[model samples]
Target chain A: MSLSVAMPDRRVRATAAVVVAAVLVVLSVVFACAVGAVHIPPGDVIDGLLDRSDPVTRQIVWQIRFPRALVAALVGANLGIAGVLLQGITRNPLGDPHILGFSAGAGVAAVGLLRVAPEVPLALVPAAAFGGALASAALVYALAWRGGISPVRFALAGVAVAALFTALSTALIATSKLFTQAALAFLAGGLYQRGWEHVHQVWPYTLVGGLIALIVADSLNVLALGDDVARGLGMRVERTRALLAALAAVLTGAAVAVVGLVAFVGLVVPHIARLLVGSDQRVVLPLSALLGALLLVLSDSIARVVVAPGEIPVGIITAIVGAPVLLILIRTRT
Target chain B: MRSSARRTTAILGTAVAAFALLLTACGTDETAVPTATASAQGTATAAATQAAPVGVTVTDLMGRKVTVAKTPTKIVTTSPSALEMLYAAGGTAIARSSTAAAPGIDTSKMTDIGSAYQPNFEAILKLQPDLVVADASAQAPLAGQFEAQLKGVPVVFVGAVKYADVATSIRMLGLVTGTAEKAKTSADAIDATAKQVGDAVKGKTATKTLVVVAGRDGQLSAALNDSFIGDMVKIAGAQNIAAELKQSGQVPGYATISLETAFKDNPDVLLVIVPGNTPGPSISSIVARTFPNLNAVKNKRVHEISLDIFLQAPGPRAADGLKELTTFIQPDVKLGAAVVPGY
Candidate 1:
């Protein structure tokens, strides 16, 4: 194994990767803001930012493009860290927030609420989704526990729970005729037409989740060493795993709450981060967040322009790009 | 072994061909024709002329040629837009699919035949409609199911995706309903309205417009070329920012554009078309609060229009839709205000 080899240079590599990723995230935000269905010259984009003299340009920058791009970066950061936490806790490379069925649980509860109460105030629907995700996470945790949770058992339970929750959500959609179009689109996972109200909704959870992940960063590093080793090292492995998973659920729930479900970001971003820097959770976590933010912001920007005035699903763009990046990583690693 | 496998393949091919033939032979044209005797609530308006049936060989929007024994007495529209077109053509139906409750049409006596996209074949058949019409442009994949359900009933599809298609489809509906004269009157009225819009903006400079449909899902998508609203925007003498984009999948001439691109295009006129019963702050608020620099918002030109006029059977009141678009895009051009149809 290259673990011993990778260990020595990891600190330096991680620091370098972090700087590179941070730079990329900032650049992605700028790129997204400057380009859209409407074209503003790069100078005007910069001028719109610093000068604010051109009313139209200023509005496009500050009001529309800026908020959208900012929200995208924020969402990326949320999903990115969530991916790191979930993957670390489960010791499953394929693991992400959905490993706890957060998305499906959020979907079921959101659909049920939408069907039962046609008017659950648009601003507050994310709360309903967050509630659903927590509930599903609880369910997955309860079922996966047999004295203590193993990664395989927990993942299988999560998959099953996700399936059940997804089915229940679809059943609600199928049976309810009064569900609004927004209600359905909310479940499809895109930031299309999302604005500041959405930004307001996701901000608290992102702050809380990101901070929690940072505080628990050392715990995650200990937990990544198998449970026996972690326990021997005086770490409360089960409790730490639970806390990390819960934090991931919160982050995933928050992301899903705002954009419904953006595919591949949470699943792909962490591994890509680890591949860029070594497998040190401390380094990988922030790197994942930056990479996730950069990837989504850039993908969203492309989603806006690829068809010009028309936009395709952002998930499609991410998957198209994400799958290839992941495949290359797998082949090169193999 | 290979010969035996070949023999099985030949047998299976024969069976498939036989099945196809059987499906084709399941019903004859005579059985598909609805009886002219009993007319439904809306169809009775045509009863005065239905007593003497006339046969017309007409090609539908999908290019399927259909022969009608007489004007259909019982009619069902699967989509809201088609129902609107049917009403505008001065025809009525005995039943409609679930989402067909548009303004002005009375659905109290109409049976709900499921949804326009997945209409209940049994319910549609129970009505014994002489003719069934659906929006082919919206649900072309469902066409075969309707055709397969035909015991003798002729199912016609209309592509009411544009202002022109609305008038053409209305004229076709007139042909199917023995209301050709009535259809002509309504079509001419719509055409006259178009002429009015054209005349008002005859020599005016067109505005570069962006029409984004605010979906019920809180999504904003660009209304592209050939779309109902896209076409209306063009006829009103405005340049569509999403112009030249081809129709895609189920959405036809619309594509989801990011808010950045939408704002970047900086349309002179921006129209947000909300395609649902409930209106939310997702779009209006975003445009007002988030894009203050947009020419539309800065000049107070970001207009929010309901789905009824935009999505209701394309072209039903398109002349009116065009008129409104013209006034917004070319304010100096004076076009008379038109009624907001039944909705």
Candidate 2:
């Protein structure tokens, strides 16, 4: 007399992961919204969201905290997709959009633009960042290509390029006394004094980049397998890899444009998603998005609470958590 | 492998194109030669625009001859101390280097160049200043570098050590900028204000006042005897905790001290000057929180003041800062009667 257990179908498993991830994302948003310089209760946050509160509380929750929380979630999702795409194209577990010079490129360009045209509308920052990221990714790709793109060569090139761009950006900030302190905080990556204007600025890029990433999801899956195998499966391997890389670059650039160079989410989220769900792009991509949003929201919450009235940089919190996790993965792999 | 190669080539080509585009975009906005000439001409024209031919040539503390035609039509000042002195000396100049958003200056005409530490060289050049005034003690080392770039344009470096030196700086800047009478009036006002503040705090059971400046990474440096603000605190009848420590040799600032030494001193009235915002775990807050045994925190006598007033320039506003200090140390003292406006 044996009880038999049946395995869940592929669609059912994917659906379950998505549903669970969505719930976690919602919880993360709620948690992040509740913690800040002025702590709004979870009930107040909901009330504010539904427009059922008094003017003052409603302004705090809706106008201030909600935009920041939403930006964090969107940035996290963008980073997750970008990381997944980057890893998939490069076939390197350590690959991240920032490590690949995309964010550094965007940062340098954004700071340069701001310096040259201080009066330029802030809405143009994302476009400038996108252009910068695209340029950087291109540079890394070119430098690594000795005839064909080698994964190790690409990673090495990215590391070098990222260092170069970050150094240049620092130099620019140091020389100009006018924006040094402001630029320093911006480069450090925090969401202080940001509002709905910033949210609206980055949303279009995030949406477009995310949509592009989803469109190239199949191509990314094909490109994830070794070049020869992917080509053998009748996929235009080179074209697919290039498209996925471009998609990653756009997403990364847009996010960095909005919030200076935030580290770890892109690299860590995808790897975690891959571990939980198999390396299948369809499951990995969506799961990574959920996990990315959750990680950032939690990190931001910690940033708000740990310092209380004064908030620590979100980048610092992410590095503290992500660096250890990354080390464990490397140690295990080795 | 072939496909990977093609993909790599395409990516490389695209990147090269993007790099070229970025260079081109930046190159288009490069400072034009005519703009440089125009700025120079603007400085020249500023001298001609003055109402009087009030020509004055004075050797600054650093021994550089600064010639000003009718005072300064467009003066750019770095360091709040220098700005305060200039204002005290009857010079209506623009502050080009201010870190704080609220500089406490009449912002109608003053344009901030961000922070003093990182003075925007480009913005300074754009301002086309006739006279550039700054502290000789702090900014003297960079005088040659600035002079060479300005190409004969004079930079007056005013050296102020004690509160008394602030008067000397005011007189010197006044002579150079053709405001000697105004400078004397300003100097007298500052002295009177100091005396008033001093009289209020006198005989009021002196509390062991500790003057500390916050360094990078939460480090604290005690202002010793003979240091600008240290001497002022003594004049105001507060004990100098870091009197034994020698003056800072590397930079013309306070000698750095360990937290252990600071705790040992354990001053009754703690006065802290931080670089920027007075946030949590700052030098003042940290001292208050970490050492419960300290007298200042226990008695609620801890005070945090702006670096500009107390630390930066000990010129005309030194009295104002000292006045604020007296009020903080002894709240019941009636010092307001002594503060005659202008004097």
TM-score of each: 0.53, 0.53
Could you give candidate 1's per-residue lDDT for residues B119-226 as a string of tens digits?
Answer: 545455546678887877655755665654443577778866667777788888888888887777777778777777777777778798998876555656788877
Runs in model 1 lying further than 4 Å from the true structure: A1-8, A51-53, A177-180, B1-343
- For candidate 2, what is the lDDT? 0.69
* Candidate 1 CAPRI classification by DockQ: incorrect
> Which candidate achieves the best DockQ against the true structure?
2
Deviating ranges (above 4 Å) for candidate 2: A1-11, A113-127, A173-179, A323-334, B1-343
Per-model CA lDDT versus the true structure? 0.71, 0.69
Mind sharing the TM-score for model 1? 0.53
Extract clashing residue pairs from model 2: A142-B12, A148-B5, B96-B113, B189-B343
Best lDDT among the predictions, by candidate number: 1
TM-score per candidate for chain A alone: 0.93, 0.88
